[model samples]
Target chain A: MSRLSKKERQKLLKQVIKDNPFLTDKELADKFEVSIQTIRLDRLELGIPEVRERTKTVAQNAYARLRSVNEGEVIGELTKLKLDNYAESYLTTTREMALQKTPIIRGHHIFAQANSLAVAVIDAEKVVTGSAEIKFTRPVMVGDVIKARAEVKEIKGKKYFVEIKIYKDSDLVFYGDFTMFKLENGGV
Target chain B: MSRLSKKERQKLLKQVIKDNPFLTDKELADKFEVSIQTIRLDRLELGIPEVRERTKTVAQNAYARLRSVNEGEVIGELTKLKLDNYAESYLTTTREMALQKTPIIRGHHIFAQANSLAVAVIDAEKVVTGSAEIKFTRPVMVGDVIKARAEVKEIKGKKYFVEIKIYKDSDLVFYGDFTMFKLENGGV
Candidate 1:
């Protein structure tokens, strides 16, 4: 038979597991008449996060797992980095976080917090922002405790890019990038 | 009169308004000891917005002001823009916002809310994410409402670059962004 289309393969795979949540990859392979590897590939494409290590990710904060940083970690001081995620940074209004009277704390402070954490976790001491895009999905206000989690997504030559997500608790309030440049000294 | 350095001009301008809450253009000119035309030019160069009859922006919703949505005013309709003067936003948990959550709301819902708002306020209808640099600054759990804001700094042809900030009830939560793209008719 001609090779099945990607869409067709996915449809067939979904149908096989429509009744059960615990279908094994091998079982899926047997029913779909495909190799286990193909089934696994399909699962990945479908965004079905593997069930094997749910705790490693789901149990602990996704941010903590990505980096060595522990869950519920708080940054006490924003140290200096010659270059931040992007050559830019949020400087003012940071002190206003976690205050009362202001119905909403402010968005800039959140952005700064994200940027600061990204810079702190860098492997290179001097890194700059090459380019980035971010989506602001919610309102952050004063007194809200913010925790930043970041991961190194890719390392290409001298350029390193990381993905960071900010959560007030379970809600992902912010998401963006931290672009860092590796210094010639090899210190991050 | 000799031209002033950037620093000197800034200091002089500050001295003029040392105690006043506001300064008129003519008043600014006299204080700076420069022509009205010079003061006007300085204001533009410094990115100072002119105060007028103080027409409220069409969209007054937290997102609209932060993103700077552009459209005819529609009373009672919240602004969709996502940036404000201070790159700020306010936040309260769903329990606090006292608003019902929709199905579209998810881990990425808050992020998408602010991102989409930012995109909607862009001068063009067509837009795409060029890249994103982010960090998850705080834990946004259920019941926490976040306020977010972003600013546009650089504009290159179809590209509208920006910086953003987020907060949760007077607390600084998230911030960042160095670039964005304004598509030509939705074509990449």
Candidate 2:
């Protein structure tokens, strides 16, 4: 093996931590054949967070709960109706949209698919978005046959947590948890 | 005065409340000479939330307090030297990176700005993101001297809430509150 310079060693250490986040510091130190302090310095230099801290924070905001939909038969038809709600909608591969082979569609069309379903989840006549946090895990394109589903997760003081999931066939594609507020009748 | 149809009235009502979120239903009803219920229906049909609910949610998230900084001069100098501790680095728009001018810099650059600034805020030996929820607010352009500032807002267990604010020419542009976890020293 070629002798690694300090800069090269540090870069390697950073890459190791980034690629394998679950690896413990002691394990990393042992693998690198370096002192623990050296590993620590490498981490500090590279800005890799501690395991416990990173895991806890990620768990706090992450609302990913995957479940099978045996109701695909019903969901499929609902998906078509849900899509028709948009001003103009279609299904195509990611390549189609990326290549601009068809009329360009706005990103909001996808957003509205998830949004309209979330809006429908509120049993109230008037629902407003109190807080919305979404994570786009993958790129969505036409011909994906994406199915959108929203479920009520939390309810407190006229506020509700509605989890919306978008799936391409059976694979999970996009997920978001929207916190909505039910507006009072005739009240602002 | 021209007589407006119900559809016209509803459209006007939506425009009014959307532009000025501070307006109340009663005030709108009074201005439009319509019943309170009419105004509420208009809001419900248009998917507009009440101001109170939005204000309350904003307060809970502590974003309302930061709103005061929107029009003021925010500091951009580094008080600590941890630049070498980051895995990535780059400049981003004060607003959303997606809104930046196309065929210019890559989105990775904007992601790096938030990531590096977040690394700097940890004040730890190493920091990495367990999860993050980023929302683009506005567009950014080149030659914009962006000052990205990140602060450890909340610390629960090992996860830290790193709030990042990007400023361009003294204007608050991009704001991201990322949840980062602290990793063990020397851990990969």
Candidate 3:
């Protein structure tokens, strides 16, 4: 593809980073066909930190507002949560989560991310999974960053119905419907 | 409880070890109110290996028979697997899998063991989770050993229905019903 003009590239840079915050400066420069200095200037002008800083900021904000689960209990970094309404989280497949013989990511890691998000979206003192219907559309590999979004579809009595969708750069990798039970008495 | 006779204790020892192979010899001795040497002698008579050896034996056997997933893809050490039929696995909750503040085991780790076993029991080249219904009966803690069993309930075309139950020391901790999809063409 042809190189983008400076003004157009700067406009696209913000969108690209927003979509995938893990991209390194070198990668951004290559994608935009711009010099590293120019890419750095664009990022500075946009008030966007480096990839690592951006990741840390997102993690801290999400973890600070966590309610349903402890800070470290979540399988992924929660980015948004609306308590019995909707939630969003992000996870990067790591070497430990991949098959030793094949570089493919294990299915459980993907499932865990969605399941935890489902539980986190519930507005209750205690929540547990009652049931789930899930699908994996594609096999994810190590180093892939997954963005998972969960929405509360219904609430009846002590049960919360949640729908979760996971993506790797707009490709649907996994989806699930989870029924979570809330503990009103807060015993277990 | 009152102490049992030697013969009764020995019989109970074997049963306990069979149900929870992760129990150490010292733990067994404590439970039986016997010396550690007596426990060792009983294990020898019963033809049972030590805890570590038993765990390795179970893992090796399960990994050898694995077909759908790679050796490391399964969440826990599989003890049994019959393709399109039934499977069993074991997992020990660790510090990393617990809530940082409360030390309660995270729900996803329990779900992962069941979900992965559900996928591993499928007789397919590429299997993916379609949906699941699950329930967590009680909160698990670090150091708890969970044994999960998965049974294939039905298979139609490329869809598999599986039922999973998880136990911690003979107490049901979690249960799930899973629907998995198999890719017939095996592209991704």
lDDT of 3 by residue, A1-188 (tens): 37877788878899998876777898888777878899899999889999899878777876776667877667787777777788888897899886454566777788889888887777766676776767777888899888999999988888888999999878999888888887664422
Question: What lDDT does candidate 1 reach at residue A66?
Answer: 23
lDDT (Cα atoms) of all candidates against the true structure? 0.47, 0.49, 0.81
Off by over 4 Å in 3: A1-5, A26-38, A70-72, A82-85, A101-103, A121-127, A153-159, A181-188, B1-5, B30-38, B45-47, B70-72, B123-126, B156-159, B181-188
Tens digit of lDDT per residue, candidate 1, span B138-163? Answer: 44555554656667776778776666
Task: Report RMSD (Å) for each prediction in the order shown.
Answer: 16.5, 21.4, 4.0
Q: Candidate 1 vs candidate 2: which has greater TM-score?
A: 1
Ranking of candidates on TM-score, top first? 3, 1, 2
- Residue-wise lDDT of candidate 1 within A1-188, one digit each (tens)? 34688799898667644433334687667766779898889988887655444323433332332221222321322222222232111122243442232344334346545644554455543433443455555655544544456666777777778676866545777787655554344543
Whole-model lDDT, candidate 3? Answer: 0.81
TM-scores vs. true structure, each candidate: 0.31, 0.29, 0.81
Cα displacement (angstroms), candidate 1, residue B87, comes to 13
Ranking the candidates on DockQ from highest down gives 3, 1, 2
List, residue by residue over B47-93, the lDDT tens digit for candidate 3: 89999999888778877877778887788888887788888998978
Query: Per-residue error at A103 for model 1, in Å?
Result: 1.7
Give the native contact fraction of candidate 1: 0.12
Clashes of each: 96, 26, 10
